[model samples]
Target: MGINTLAFLLFFVFGITVFYLLPQRLKWPFLLLLSLSYISFKDIRGIVFIVLSSLSVFLGGRLFEKRNEPKDASFRKKILILTMIFNLGVLFFVKYVKPIYGAFSGKTPPELDKIPFFDSIIIPLGISYYTLQILSYLLDVYWGRQKAETNYGKLLLFTCYFPQMIQGPISRYGALSAEFFKEHRFKLHNLKFGLQLMLWGFFKKMVIADKVGPYVQRIFFSHKEPYGLTVVLGLIFYGIQLYCDFSGGIDVIRGVSECFDVKLAENFRQPYFSRSLGEFWRRWHITLGSWMKDYVFYPLSLSRPMAKFKKSLKKKVSRVTVNRIQIAICDIVVFLLVGYWHGAESIYWAWGLYNGIILAISALLTDVYAGWRKKLGVDPKRKLWDNLFIARTLVIVTVGWIFDCSKTALGSLNLLKNAFIISKTSFEPIVLNLVDWVEIAELIIFCAILFKVSRMKERGVVVREKIEALPFAVQVIIWVGMIQLVACFGRSSGEVGFMYANF
Candidate 1:
C-alpha cells in the first residue's frame, strides 16, 4: 500500500472519514487497529516489525527509567548503545545479509536459522525508518533531552503512526509524543492544504519522475557503449529522477499527515538551488541529515580525541588542524555510513566514499583559497563568479550521481570516459531527433516551473491561501484540472515505486 497507489488512496479516505467521526478518546485505538489492519493487508510479516519496534522502545524506555532510579548514567548509556546496536543489527540482517546470501547460495537457511515461523525474513515496509525513529527515541531518553514514555500504547503509537508508517520525515519522540495523545480535530484548512500538496506530489512523481524514467532506463539497461554526452545526459536525468521520486514521496507522506492534523517535518527544500555540497545536504533529506548531525556528528566532534585535537590546534599548528578539517573528517565518516545505509553493495560504498572525498577536498581548500583571494583583493563573494562556482559544483555533484546509479565501478568509469574523455568522432548519439527535442523541451519547462515554485517557497508565498480565497467554483475547476492531469499522465501501472522506498 504505497502512498502513491490507489489502495492507499482508498485506505486513506476511509481512515480519515472514520477518524474524524469517531469520539476523540477512541481515535488513537481506532487508528492503531487500522495500522495493524493495513500492515496485515500489505504483508503479515509487517506485524513482526511493529512488534519488534514497539517492544524495543517499550523496553528501552523502561531500562532507561531503571538506570535513572539507580543514578547510574553510565549503565543507562551502555544500555542505550546496546539497544541501538541490536536494532541496527536486526535491520542490517533482514535488509541486506539474507537477500545477499539467497542471491548467491540459491538455498534457503535452515528452519532453525529462520525468524520463528516466517520461512524467510521479509524486511517490512519502513523498517529502516521506524528502527531509526525508535533508536533516536531511546538515545533522546539517555541524553535527558526527552523523558521515557512509560505508557506502552502511546510509545507504540509513536512508532507506528499510520500516516508516517511507510515513508517519513522521521519524527522525533519529543516532537510527536504529545500529538499522539492529544485529541485530533478535523480542519478544513488542513484538509485543503494536504490535498493540494498530495496533488503536487503526484504531479512530480507520476508526471515528472516517471516520464524521465524511461529515458534513464533505456540508456542504463541498453548495455551498449553510449557516447559520453548521452551518458552525461542520462546521469542528469537520474539526478532529477531521484529528487522528484524521493521528495515526492515525502510530500505525499507529509500531506497525509496533515490531513490527520499532524505536521510532519519537511524533507526537502529546493536542494538543487544549493550553492555547495554542505548546503545541498542541509536541504536534501533534511530529517535524516538533522538526525545524523544531532545524534552522530555533534557527539563525535565533542568526543575526547576530536576535542583534544581542537584544543591542541588552537594553541599550536594553527594552519594544520582547523575546524573545517575536523568537520570534514567527521562528514566523510558519517557519509560513508550514510552510503552503506542504503544497502550492502560495493557501488553504494563507493558512492559514499566519492562524496566524502569531494567534501573533504572542498573543505581543505576552502580557507586557503579564501585567504589567497582576500590577499589578492579578489572579492570571493562576487555574484557572477559565485554563480559560476555554484554551476560548476552542481556539475560535479551530478557527475557523482553517475557513480551512485552505476552497477559497477568499471561501468561508471566507462560512462564517464565516454561522456568527457573520448573524441568527437567516437561519440555515439543515443537520443534520436524527435525524442531529443521533446526531452529538451520537457526539461526546460520542468526547470522553469521548479524555479518558480522554489522561489515562491523561499519567499514564503502561499499560493494555496490565495486559491482558497478564490471563489469555490474556481477552486473546484483547478482541482478538476489537477485530477484530469493525474488521470491522463500518472503512473497507473504502480510498477514505478518511490525511489527512497528501496533505501
Candidate 2:
C-alpha cells in the first residue's frame, strides 16, 4: 500500500496494536508475518521478488563467511563480487533493459514477453532500495566488518521491513537486524513522537507537495512556449515539490519504524539550507551518501591507482593542492554513480554530471576565493552577509531543478530560455488563468509551516519535543486541523504516488 493512504493508516494502527499486545518473544515473528501479509496485500507476486532478494543476500552472506578460510579468500572475494553483480543485474534487467531494448529495436523484446504469466517480471516495490541494503550487508560481511546473520527470517525481514519496504532511508543490515529481532515494549514517548512525525509528514506530502503538483505538471507538460516568470516560478515550485515529497516519505517511514521502537537513519537535514553542493549532498539522502563513502569512494580512493597518483602528485604539489585534486576526482565519480543510480535516462546522467562539475569547481576554487576575500578584508562570518549568500546559493540550486525535471537536454534549454528571456505577454492569457485560489491559500499555509519547521531544524530543537511541550488540547487541535486539511485538499481524483517511488 502507498504510505499516504487511508488503508495504510488503518493497517499501521492495527499492526501497532496487535504488535504491542503480543508476547515479547513473539514480536519479531509477528512483525515478520505482518510485513509479509502487508506485501501480500499489495500483490502476491511481490513475494517472488522478496524471495529472490532474500536468497541473494543469504547466498552472499554464506559466500562471505567462507572468505575467512586461507585457501578460499581469493575465490570468496570473486564469488562475493559476482553475487553483487547478479543482484544489481536483476534490478537493472527488471527496471531498465526492456525500455532500452524497445527504444532501440522498435519493438518489445521476445525474451521479456516469454516469461510465465504468473512469474512475469514486474519491478518489485523498493527493489532498488532493498537490493542496495542487502548488497551493502554482503559487502560488510566480506570485509569482516559485520557477521552474517544466521537467521534467515531476520535477513528477510531486514530487507523487507514493511515500513521501509517501499521508499527508504536504506538502513544497513548491521544497523537494523539486531533491532528487528529484539523485543519491543511500547513506549509512550515513542508513540507520541511517531504520531507527531506522521502529522508533519502529512502536512508536507498532502498539503505542500500535492498542492504544487498541478502547477508543476502543467508547466512541464505544456506544449506552448513558456513565459520567463512562469518558467522561473515553475522551477521554484518544483524544488519545493521535490523536497516535500521525498522528505515527507522519509518522515512517514521513520515514524512507523519508531512505532516499533526501531530508529531508522535520518534521510534529510534541511538540504535547502546547505551553502554548497558538497554540503547539500551531506544533508540530502544522507544514508546513500554514507553508503557511497564507506563502500565506494573511500575504497576507490585508497586503491592502487589513486594512491599512486596522490603520492606522485604530492611530490610536485602542496598538500592542499593534492587534497583538492583527490576530492574533485572522487566527487565526480561518486556524483556520476549517484546520477546513474537514479535512472537509466540521459537526463539523470546530465543532472549528476552538472552537480559534480559544480562541486568540483567549488572545491578547486575555494582556497583561491578565500585568499582573495582575505586580502580584501572581507568577513564571510557576518550573519547578515552570510545569510544573503545562502539565499543566493539556494536560488541557484533551485534553478538547477529544471535540469532534474526536464525530459531532454533540449527541453531543459528551452525551459531555461523561457525562464530568463520570454515576455509575459506571450503566455499570460493561458498561464494567468490557471491559478487556483484554494491551492494558493494552501501553498501559503504550507510555506508558513515549512518556515516554522525550518527554524526549529536550524535551532537543533527536536520536533517531537516541541510537539509534546504543547498542551493536550493544542496537540489535539493541531491533529484535527491537519486531518481536516488533508480531507479537504488531498488529491482525490487518483493516486498521487510518491515521486521517488519510480527510483
Candidate 3:
C-alpha cells in the first residue's frame, strides 16, 4: 500500500501497537512474522526469493566470520565474492533480465516455457533496497566493522523490517541492528515527534505532489510536441513532484521507525540549496551516495591498478592535481553505477554518463574556475555568489531531469533542444488548461512556504524541536490545523505510488 494511504496508516498503527504490547523476548519474532506477512501481501514469490537470499547471505556471513583470520583471509574473500555474485546474479535475473531479454529477442524466449511458475514470478518489492542492504551487511562483516549475526530470526527481521523495506534510507548493519533489537517503551514525545513527521510527509505527498501531477502529465504526455516553456515547466514540476514524493515517503518511513524508537539515516539535507552538482548528490539520496562511496568508489579508487596509475601521474602533475584526477574518475564511475541502479534502460545509462561528464569537467576545471572567480573578485562565501551557485546547480540538475523524465534518450534531447529555443512566449492558456490563475497563485504561495521551511532547515534550525518547546495546547492546535488543512486539500491520482518505489 502507498505509505500516505489510510491502509498503510492503519497497518502501521496496529503494527506499532502490538510491537510495544509484546514482551521483550517476543519482539523480534513478532516483527519477523509481521514482516513476512507484509511481504506476502506483495507476492508469494517475493517471500521465497527474500528468504533464500537472506539465508544465503546469512550462511556466507557465518562462513566469512569463521574464515576471517589472517591465514584464512583468502578463503574469506572467496566467500564474499561468491555471495556477492549470487545475490547480484539473482537481482539481475529478476529485475534486469526482462529488459535485456526484450532488447535482444522480439518475443519471449521459448526456453522459459519449461520453468515452473517463471511467468508468474516477478521482481519483488524492495529487492533493490534489501539486496544493497544485505551486500553492505556482508561486506561490513568481511571488513571487520561488524560481527555476523547468528540469530537467523533477528537477521531476517533486519532484512525485512517493514518500514524501510519499502523505499529506504538504506541502513547499515553496525548502526541500525542494535536499535532494531532494542525494546522501546512508548513515550509521549516519540509519538508526537513521529506523528508530526508523518503528517508533514502526507502534506508533501498528497497536497503538493498530487496537485502538480496533472500539469506535469499535460506537458510530458501531450499528443502534439510541447514547446520550450511547457517542457521547462514539465521538467521543473517533475523535479518538485519527484523530490516531494520520494523524500516525503522517506519521511514517512523514518517517522514510522521513530515510533518504534528506531532511527533511520537521514536521506535529504536541503538538496535544492546545494551550490554544486557534487554537493547536491552528497545531500540528495545521502545514504545511497555514501553507500556507493564506501563500497564501490573508495575500493576501486584505492585498487592496485589505480595506485600504479597515480604513481605514473606523479611525475607529470602536482600531487593536488593527481588527487583531483583520482577523485574525478571515482566520482564518474560511482555516478554511472548510480544511474544503472535506477533501471535497466539506456536512458538511465545516459543520465548517469551525463552527470559523470559534468562532474568530471567540473573537477578538471576547478583551477580555472577558481582563478576566474578570483579575477572577478567573487567571494563564494558571500550571499550573492552562494545564491548564484545554488541557482546554477538547480538548472544543471533540472537539465539532467529531462533525461530522467523522458521516454528515451532522443526524446530527452529533443526536449533539451526545445528548451533552448523558446517557441511560445505566452503560458497563460497553457497554465489555465490544468489550473486556474488563483490556484496557480496558491501553488506559488505553497512553494514559497516550502522554500522558507527548507531555508530554516538549511540554516541548521531544529524546527520540530522548536515546535515541541511550545505550550502543549498550542502544539496540539498546530498539529490539528495541519491535519485539517491536509484533509481539506489533499488529493491522490488513484494509485499514489512513490516514484522511487519503481526502482
Better of 2 and 3 by lDDT: 3
- Give every collision pair in model 2: none
Number of the top candidate by lDDT? 3
TM-score of 2: 0.92
* Better structure of 1 and 2 per lDDT: 2
Top candidate when judged by TM-score against the true structure: 3
CA lDDT of every candidate: 0.78, 0.81, 0.84
Name the candidate, 1 or 3, with the larger TM-score value.
Answer: 3
Q: Which runs in model 1 stand beyond 4 Å of their true positions?
A: 69-71, 99-119, 308-316, 319-322, 372-383, 422-428, 433-443, 470-474, 492-495
Measured with C-alpha atoms, the lDDT of residue 71 in candidate 2 is: 91
What would the per-residue lDDT of candidate 1 be over residues 1-503, giving only the tens digit for each residue?
77777788899999999989999889888778887787788788887777876787679888877778556877877777778888888888788886466546654556325645345567787787888888888888877788888778787777777767666778898878766667788889989899898888887888778888877887776656666567777888898888888888788888887888777888998887677788888999998889888888898888999988888788765646578778888888888888877876667777888888888887878878788768877654787766766687688789888776577667777677778755563334453421566655866676576567878877688778877899999999989987886677665666577778877
Residue range 1-503, candidate 2, lDDT tens digits: 79887799899999999999999888988888988888888787877887887887787787678567889878987888788888888888887876566556555457547646423667777888888888889888888898988888888888788888777888998779767767688889888778768767777887789879888888777666566777877788898999989998889889888888888999999988876667777998899899889888898888899989999999999989888888888888888888878886667777778788888887888888798878977666888766766786787688678776577656787778777776647457344676886778768877887988887887799866776789999988877987887677666675688988888
Scanning candidate 3 in windows of ten residues, the lowest lDDT window is 106-115
The Cα RMSD in angstroms, rounded to one decimal, for candidate 1 relative to the true structure is: 3.5
Ranking by lDDT: 3, 2, 1
> Model 1 — which ten-residue stretch has the worst lDDT?
425-434
TM-score of each: 0.90, 0.92, 0.95
Cα displacement (Å) at residue 381, model 3: 2.0
